[model samples]
Target: MGGYGSGRLHDGRVLCMGGPWVSAIAKDDRFVAGWVTHATRWGIVRGRGNSGGMGGLRMSYRRLYVPGATYFFTVVTYDRRPLFSDPVNVQLLREAFRRVKQHHPFTVEAIVVLPDHIHTLWTLPEGDADFSTRWRLIKTYVSRRCAKTYQPPGSASRQQKSERTVWQRRFWEHLIRNQRDFDNHVAYIHNNPVKHGLATTPEAWPHSSIHRSP
Candidate 1:
């Protein structure tokens, strides 16, 4: 029986808690089931009927990965907490992105950070579809630095795993299939702050990358 931080995958590979929960990936990069745990702001949920072991249930969702492509992402804070309402936290988020980008290069096409969520577009380098790992590192960096001040009290299960409540366990990601899709996502990212009534216009949002656009 593996606890929150570690487990064994279907193929008997060791699973490490890089992020909030562990995603068991097979040799072919497919997510398989074994000792799977999913986390929310409230607590961690293990597979049905499995109390303390590393085997049970299956993951129903599949993530799409395309090398050298554009992606749109919507990432939210745990329990929709307004952690980004403070400008300092927004700067911290930027620092995390910068730190991750230095080692794993990616282009930030567009981005907007709101009080509780963020919308952004990114372009991965050729032959690289490992955005998942990049995101894991970024989240880890932010969580390590901001957990004390921004993170709420987590559940016992989460505390056992040493999970931070900074960001949601999962984020919404979309692979951009065409130029039209990229344009639409960029527009959506810029307008999101206004839609949420955080700003009168997109340009009024100081934390967004819109001001840096040509």
Candidate 2:
């Protein structure tokens, strides 16, 4: 049983419709899972399950596509595995991003890598709003380079599609509303390690783009 409300989205784990952005409560509630025009018009389609629910069951979200627009994303490893804890895994992920960017360009505005998950902001190239493709390539690259055999098994649906079990089949994304939203999400990305007690401060997290700041 669920219904829609003014759900709030933090951590880039949820997407908002009908407005510039949204924040959500953690529980599963009926969400307005639909597409939105860059002109701020919403096409509402109701949906169930939480933001990070099981794959294939939660494709109700028709991602709002906006070319060259800035977006925030959160992606997680299967079963919350600390796949990024190893330096080799981390380096592989960086290489995956670079490989994807070489073909499909996107600007990495802000990024933070945690042991089990990652949050990032990106600006797609002009006339190219296919962030989904970029993510697919990045995940595929990393999974191929750092294949994990003991990972949790994929859902039957995922198997049918030949999807990777290393990463969650779904990711959370939000279109940046404005400069203030962009700034706020970037800070959130930087502060994530501290929030999770992985670091004393954002700068202490070596796996983040905060280290790029001089």
Candidate 3:
């Protein structure tokens, strides 16, 4: 907010806009949510969702303190609402997630890559922190990668200030609190394929948490 741009981030609306969106950021507890934003038509966001501390954290704060527990994260593609990816693309997305993990040294405890979306349970490493920055970096990188792979059905159209298209700009997340939540999220990600009838059993889906979980 203060460091990167100018004054307070303009209040914007969480518009279910037609373009791509972003997922929630889990940076340090103090400012991660500020980064996860929705698209607004008139540059008007939903209120004080715009608060930045101006200066970037000193080098010391870069190694911020984060809990070692598991956290839930969800991100979606640019309105590609249905799970639509070749095995290769899915793998690429997973690789991108892997890159994100390196930054924080976290374990993707669970993950499900739906045709249009993804859910992950990430556990931050000891001492390292800030899930928000991790999500932001992942979204940016994966979206860029997804753009390269996404080929439109027909001739391409020219757009101003933009060339690539792949993912939405925003996402949602939840910090896993207890055993029930963990089990429920695991079930939710695994059952995603079943809910879509993509497979008779969750294990049948190649792109899901079921495969990652032991």
lDDT of candidate model 3 versus the reference: 0.51
Q: Write the per-residue lDDT of candidate 1 for residues 64-144, one digit (tens) a residue.
A: 455565667777798888988888888888898888888998777778888998888777765666788888998888888
In model 2, how large is the Cα lDDT of residue 51? 58
lDDT of 1 at 148: 81
lDDT per model vs. reference: 0.65, 0.66, 0.51
TM-score for every candidate vs. truth? 0.70, 0.71, 0.59
* Per-model RMSD to reference: 13.5, 10.0, 14.2
* Candidate 2 local lDDT, 65-119, one digit each (tens): 6665677888999888899988888898888888888888877767888999999
- What's the TM for model 1? 0.70
What lDDT is obtained when candidate 1 is compared to the true structure?
Answer: 0.65
Which residue pairs clash within candidate 2? 7-23, 8-23, 8-24, 9-22, 9-23, 9-24
What tens digits encode model 3's per-residue C-alpha lDDT throughout 76-151? 6765644255776676776767776555556665677778877766665544446767777766665566664563
- Which residue pairs show collisions in model 1? none
Model 3 residue runs over 4 Å out of place are 1-66, 81-84, 148-165
Instruction: For each of the candidates, give the backbone clash count.
Output: 0, 6, 30
Lowest-lDDT window of 10 residues in candidate 2? 1-10
Model 1 stretches with alpha carbons more than 4 Å out: 1-61
